[model samples]
Target: MRIVRRVFVPTLVVVVAVIVGSGIAGGREAFGGAAVGGGLTLAFLGASPGLLDPVAKASPVASLPVALGFFTVKAVAAVAVLMLLLGDDGRGPQLSSRAVAAAMIITALTWVTLHFRALRRVRTPIYDLG
Candidate 1:
């Protein structure tokens, strides 16, 4: 349990970092597209309990449904991006490049917070174990 809790948040941070880096290099459209796709994938995996079992069982048809689900979600997210970009005027608080950068920084800080929490949880003795 400790291992799972320790690794899960850091893994999420790593994934967010990868997505942000890819977006920075590939431009806004590419980054947005990738974010939509990756977010759907992650959300699907997190929500669906049996989705991965078929893949592990090597059952292609069973895997098809999960794949379709993720694809549908990604498509919806992409459409959402299109709607936001096309419909919104330059008025409200927009998500600029700077916002994306700040979000990435916040994600890193989240990882640091998790690390500190884990460190605090570790038991320390007056005498050294070694």
Candidate 2:
């Protein structure tokens, strides 16, 4: 929970900043694209720990496979989003794909960086006598 909070706060700040910047640069379409990208990424990142932690605690051995499956799902979903935003077929509503991509990259970097920092600060005992 502590790590989640640590990562979520800064990531959200980055998301909002990117969305605002997109809006200023490319107007409503861009803003909407950025919002969608940021929101999806945030949902994926935010749900990871909350959803997986219980599985991990229940069966550490099973956690790895479950995590891998979860990641695969996220990856596929991201690709689907990129396809939708690309809108290269001339059949869907247009959006600034660049804005969406940018927001996703920036927010993802923030998430990874904050997670690393939080993990580094963790103090775990190597041995428990009790």
Candidate 3:
């Protein structure tokens, strides 16, 4: 929760910047693409912690496999959806593929950087032998 919140704010800022930049540079299609990109980024990454936390808490050993599986599923689904939307030549109806790709990349980087920084700062006991 705390980590998510910390990352969310900065990610939102980056998303907004990406959207605005795309809109200015590429017009309407790009704007929509940027919006969707940022939204998907938020939806996919934002839901991760909430979905995985319980699994981690209940069975730490299973968490890694679960996370990897979850990620694989997401990636496949996303690719399928994008393929349907973008077609063979990346020509979507009204969405600019470049804008979508750029926004997703920027937001994801922001989320990862913030997440790792926060994780590093967390204080934990060196040993818990009971």
Which model, 1 or 3, shows the larger TM-score?
3
Best by TM-score: 3
Superposed by TM-score, candidate 1 places the C-alpha of residue 41 at a distance from the truth, in angstroms, of: 1.2
The TM-score values for the models, in the order shown, are 0.34, 0.87, 0.90
Tens-place lDDT digits, model 2, residues 1-130:
7899999998999899999999999998889878977988888788889868999999999999999999899889877876776665622375667677788888888899999999999997889899
- lDDT ranking from best candidate downward: 3, 2, 1
Indicate the worst ten consecutive residues by lDDT in candidate 2: 85-94
Compared with the true structure, the alpha-carbon lDDT of candidate 2 equals 0.84
Q: Candidate 1 residues 15-118, lDDT tens each?
A: 57756775787666446544544443344334333455547478766676777776687568745654564345422233343333444454445555665687
Give me the overall lDDT of model 3. Answer: 0.89
Ranking by TM-score: 3, 2, 1
Taking all chains together, the TM-score of candidate 3 against the true structure is: 0.90
Better candidate by lDDT, 2 or 3:
3
Clashing residue pairs, backbone N/CA/C < 3 A, model 3 = none
